[model samples]
Target: MTANTHDRGAPAAPARRSGLGVALFLEATERFSFYGMLSILLVYLLDVRGLAAPRANLFVGSFNALALVSTLLGSRLGGVVLGPARTVLYGCAIQFMALVLLGLSVMWPVLFLPAAAAVAVTNGLTRTNMAVLILRHAGGGRSADGLATLYTFAVNLGAMFSFLLVPWIGRRHGYALAFGACAAGLFMGAAAALLNRRALAGGASGGTARAVPRAVAETGLAIVSYWVVLNFPAGGHWIFWLVTSAIPVFWAWAWRNATPAERPGIAICLILVAEAMFYGMFDEQTTSTFVLYALHDLNRQFSVAGVTLFELDAPQIVAINAGLTMLLGPVFVVLYRLVDARFGTVALSVKYVCGSVFIVIGFLVLCLDTAGGAPGLRAPWGMFGAYAALSVAGLIMNGLGLSVVTTYLPARMRTMSVAVYYISTGLAMYGGSVLANAMGIGRLHAATPIPESLSTFHALFRGFTLLAACGAGGIVLLLPVLRRLERRAG
Candidate 1:
């Protein structure tokens, strides 16, 4: 659960909640499907398609951005066209189709991009709906705690499955079979929802079939328009510029619409958004470039807390990060409580700052250990530390994003502000793709390894460290001002 939910104190009235098991099940399954697809994507692109590393990174970024941005459109339509429950059902079906295309890319090399777009739209449709469904039945009080508990558990559960199952299959079997397994997982989720249709009932009133076709069309059009931009020179840069320009505009409109009291929170949101672009650069890499590095370079013999585990392939070892997060989750909870008792309430800005710190440390760990050469069989533990640190960064940032807007931003501006944040993520994803290209990730790949190209990859890691340091430093420099703003906003 997020720090906000954790710190909510005891329930005003204790009561049991049910009917959310189906939503949580869907949540777990959706993440499993999404991350599972991604776990093998970069390696698949490199080894199977013979695409250059930068090109593959751009491919993932462009399509992933579409999916993240589509959630906005999905939220509006999911409530009506099919209702949240049915919308999720439809989305799972769509995702299954996408995965089928992805799984079979060996035969049809041309379908990957289109398949990616479908995946994004599917996530956009279902991601928010799961949480909304949970909230609908949560009512309030301890049931709300139930919501937090379920949300956290379900997310990690899905990631755990993705990291453990999907990549292992891809490493041991083949990409096609691995993707087929993900498809099967999605189908099982759909089947579960169908069998327990009673538990899945009672979402937004289902709208006409016409409504869904239009919604899907509009969303598809958005993706097409976004994809069309790939033709532009300096496409990633211009896209980043254009997307970020919307942030202040959003906050400006929101600020004017909000009460005088809400302005400070909006101000804080803008700061968080700015700093978050850097966070995106690293966070997105955990999926793309990092996984690729592991595949080509890092040692895959795995262990945790001195217990040796199996000698998994690099892609398979990515699951270990998910496992590590599960192990550390409780440690963080207890640490948060202790810190709260010892130092008083931790400010949201502080959380972001600290998150940035952890992230930078993670990057530095990797950069320092890999300074002189390609990572091949060198600095094995550093990547593991990097993964662990990044996982913590993920939790802190997730908490900040999930709770900050609702807890701080005025209710009137919450939705739009949240949209601004997510839209920035799309921009940042593009920016990250740009950086991946910039950082010489293009030089590192499978099927060929230039020993001298180690310099290029090392520069890339240093760039990551520098980007994270600068972003976090900016947040730190302005830390006092943001804290005051938070107090005033509250």
Candidate 2:
């Protein structure tokens, strides 16, 4: 891989602006399709497909893991063989086909596996490359911060609308129609990519011909590995454990290979990645544990003056986080810029610490709320507050984490580094699913009495609270080291 493939010279100002717009559009639409399908997927599996909760959760977890792990191949393909623009277009096309099959799966049922696998594989092609394109267009300095904030803003904006609309459609019409909507969104994204091909092409690194065969081989290997993990019982857990154990070894090797100037940045990136992995375990609850809690435990109705306004379904609860993210994302961007102007740079350690606090607080809120009453139809305020806190935490941790990878890593490693970060998240999601299963979330049913489940919910929330508190303590202990590394990197 040549440097040009990863570090293409910045285009002229007008072209740069145009490319950023196209990239952001693609991001927004793609997220709309992805999250729209995801928000309702768990429920669909349980209700439509008639799977038990445990099996459904495992399926969802495995799908997320495969999607992220496959990004390694996708990043290589984009960075070496197809280039970013063509890779993104192909990803959109693949996703479109997969989603159509997913829609049809509502009728055929058997198509779900292959359709889901295709979607998972397509993610590897889109996400990392899109981030690379955004970075290339934005350039450096405060643009790094801006890119992080803006990228998250685009993501949540799409997510917010999807969560609000898709679940409602699924509830009223059917899961099939909702999935069809997602496919249509992908179609629009692909059309946009085609019309703006030149602008999107500007983001490519122009990878050399020599790398194509190697990239293809690696991509094929990833596909086969994903197939094995998806098909084999307990394979996802095995892969998760293997990856978790390998992370430290990989870090050591990279540290030894890095130059003195690169070492500090690499250290900082790894630390941030660790922090993200911890946070991601908690974040996954939004779709898994939290959704289950909302579905079974919360009263989702809204009323004014003794008149019912609207009722929120379990899946609709995810919109709260997305909505909060959209609102707060810009505030963070301004805050980051203001702090950087005053203090030379916003302290990444400070961001992590603050986010860790919110994580602990979010779980604590759930614990107290659960303990306050029987599990039957408690007020939704606790869920709202917890989701709000989590949204802030996510923006602080994940948004900054992405910025750190792009800003600090050598251009050549940016896509792979991003892919690695996502793989950590995939592992976290699988772990979170396991944790949810341990709490007997899969055993829960509508008929299960609140009194019977109280201990389980209480234990789960308390355990998460403790976990978050420990993560916070770890960050505190590492603060001096993180600061020293940041200074050295500068």
Candidate 3:
């Protein structure tokens, strides 16, 4: 958005190497530390925390959804009242305390919800701010999309290691130790940014700092009120409703001030937000139903050069997907550039179509492999193959939304536009939750001793395949119109 003039005759701005490293490290640490804790959370709730599948899934969905949705509010707070630096500082401190509290929840159990909520709040404040800082200092040395791609790559790098390391710690040492490790990693990441805080300077112009204290107090009160509501008999239902209610609120908020020139681009952003729900559901398979399947159903046995290794299980299998993302990221970037050169720039909608197609392919593999295995364990290839395709799709969609919106949306609304991209992920979590509850996937029936993880997941995976196919079809149908809109908006 800063005119991205690397190709102009003017000399490209120099890279702030330390700032760039801190930003990338911060992004990497977030993925590693956050996913390290979360990859185990579903099972932790179901078994260690002694909750039923429905409740476990709901809790997982609720916390993750809350985390993603809070970014809108967090971005507003950072871009305005509290200032981005102070917001990051407070956010990291909150997350550190949250990790500690969640670690303590292993003993008390009651502490988990508030801690989870705090993590949600932390998401609002910190992660998106990191991207802003990266763009802030990246200057003409890198394109904005390249910075976005680098951040995605950084995520997988962290995830690749965290998935391997943190889970082992969780399994061998103690659950609490794993969480504590995550806390330490996040703390270190925050410290890295603190060391280079001056580099993260712009973007806090709108509201006065005097508003910070009152806003924090109001936010605290709201959180406490929401927490109290969550403890009620039908709390989860109300929470889902509460979030769904936010969709239109965000739409109006984002578009209310848009000029006619920016309207089409903003409209496309919202459409992408909706389309993301499908992929989001697909994306969540790793954490929720996929983990459950690995636990109760899959034949996870494997050998490497006749040396027996740890059987692939929940987070470990999930780690394999992250590894794929890391490995495939650069390859896709090069391929995309080559394609762009041969053919003119690929349309953002086209990339999304490819993403949806790949998701369908992944689900189809799952459905085909899981066929007739309602009572047993199929080869791990089904799971492995599914992730292989989905990982590619993930890379394609990475900077597509942010990069497009950044290009076309008014600069005044940049933070909110970025926040809009996250709304899809937020809603995607809820949609997965809805799919789980409505269809009985991963739910344990009270009358039967056996949990229906395999059969339910089979049906659910099949349903997802259909949904993704429809999504792809819908996108393809709209390509002509979207292309016209993009040209007009451009």
Candidate 4:
């Protein structure tokens, strides 16, 4: 079948478009709720729960990593047992309950870890399946690229609102209110999914009985591994290493199983996932290290005529990145279409390389800010530049990464490939956590002088800039191979 042809069991064009709209709504809501909670989680843990910076960073990082890694199990269950549509509904219901528990944890305190775990696990089921729904609704065609861009726009739009609103609510009312708002968003998503059930029909059927036992076993192992790493932060890097090391083995298995025509596409997918790990490492700092920096160093107050109007909270500062992404997304989408119209489809490798360079530039901007001898009141323009660059990098890297999975992989592999892509990010988040800790920013207390921490932050930024530069150079070296693979796949 051609790329433009509808999948075997897809609905008619009009129905499919309707389904796509519903899926996008669900995606936006889910992201809004999930990211809203995350944007405030570090502060909640530190201020409300009375945890130190190191521990709070670990908790946030582990939560993100576990949520992503568990997608392996979610993919198996969604693709083989429950089907994507059913899995999405179930995930929404579970996520709602998890958010409620998180709200309650503000009072009880003991419920915090378990509530976080619930949110993480349920995320595995929802994130990948929602993307699968979008792909199915797109009829798995060339339009998938445009739809993927729209999908990313929806994600950032929801995140932008949540990042701005949730943090404001948390700052004014309480963290519990923020959590409650997230739960409300999830409830809306669930309602939409239920109301549009017929339009979202026809996903994978339950697999053979023999496959069930192994799926259950793999899920059990994945959960146990996450538990151990979460409990033992010192050894978490090893766990992430173990998880990431399996990528090659999984790729080899997929390549061997695939037909000759499919191998090139599979190869491209693997390369993109690997490249994305570096991007994820840098990008995730917005929620962790960057938030801390803004809280301690950035001058977030707005003043006119020597009168302060409002001051931005740390989490709200993080929202600037999402807000910028929302603003920039449409411009990039139009630019990509124009390029594709004049020239044929752009190679995924080229986009990946461009994103890497942007990441390097973003981190360099941060590095320069750190070196500028600003004590506790660094200028916000440096952060603005960094956020803008990172937003563009994400629009290119993450947006196109999802498009590659949906466009190239077969139906049977699509969900699993999506899951693997997420796993790469999981590893990156964990890696970023380690890097954050090494910078010693976690050791800074409320009374600690900002100048004392400047060198450490500067060093960290310079290291990341170097790392991203090396990654971009490596991709450039492999461009010949990547282009060959694209041609073979075509």
Candidate 3, residues 64-164: lDDT per residue as tens digits? Answer: 77677777767877677776666776778778888898889988888977777777777777766766666554345455556667777888988888877
lDDT of 1 at 342: 100
Counted clashes in each candidate structure: 1, 0, 0, 0
In candidate 1, which residue ranges exceed 4 Å CA deviation?
1-16, 79-86, 134-153, 194-210, 220-238, 303-308, 333-344, 372-376, 445-451
TM-score of 3: 0.90
Q: Score every model by TM-score.
A: 0.85, 0.93, 0.90, 0.92
Q: On residues 1-490, what C-alpha lDDT tens digit does candidate 1 reach at each position?
A: 1223332332233111335677778787878888898778777877887877777788778666666666666566655456667677777888899899988876787776667667877777777666556554434432332344446557777888787888778877888899988888888878988886556655335677777778677767755665465333246566566666766777788878877876787787777776665677787777777766776666666667767766666666667667776666656666666776799757767888888999889989888876764445663577788988987886677535645555556544544444556667766776787778777876665555645455565677888888788888888899989878877875
- Evaluate model 4: give its lDDT: 0.80
Winner of 3 and 4 under lDDT:
4
Name the candidate that leads on lDDT: 2
lDDT of 1: 0.69
Model 4 root mean square deviation, Cα atoms: 3.0
Residues 308-409, candidate 2, lDDT per residue (tens digit)? 777788999999999999899999889888886888666777788999999999999999888855546677888889999999999998887777787667
Winner on lDDT between 2 and 4 is: 2
**Candidate 1 residue pairs that clash:** 67-120
State the C-alpha lDDT per candidate. Answer: 0.69, 0.81, 0.71, 0.80
Give me the displacement of residue 163 in model 2, in angstroms.
Answer: 1.2
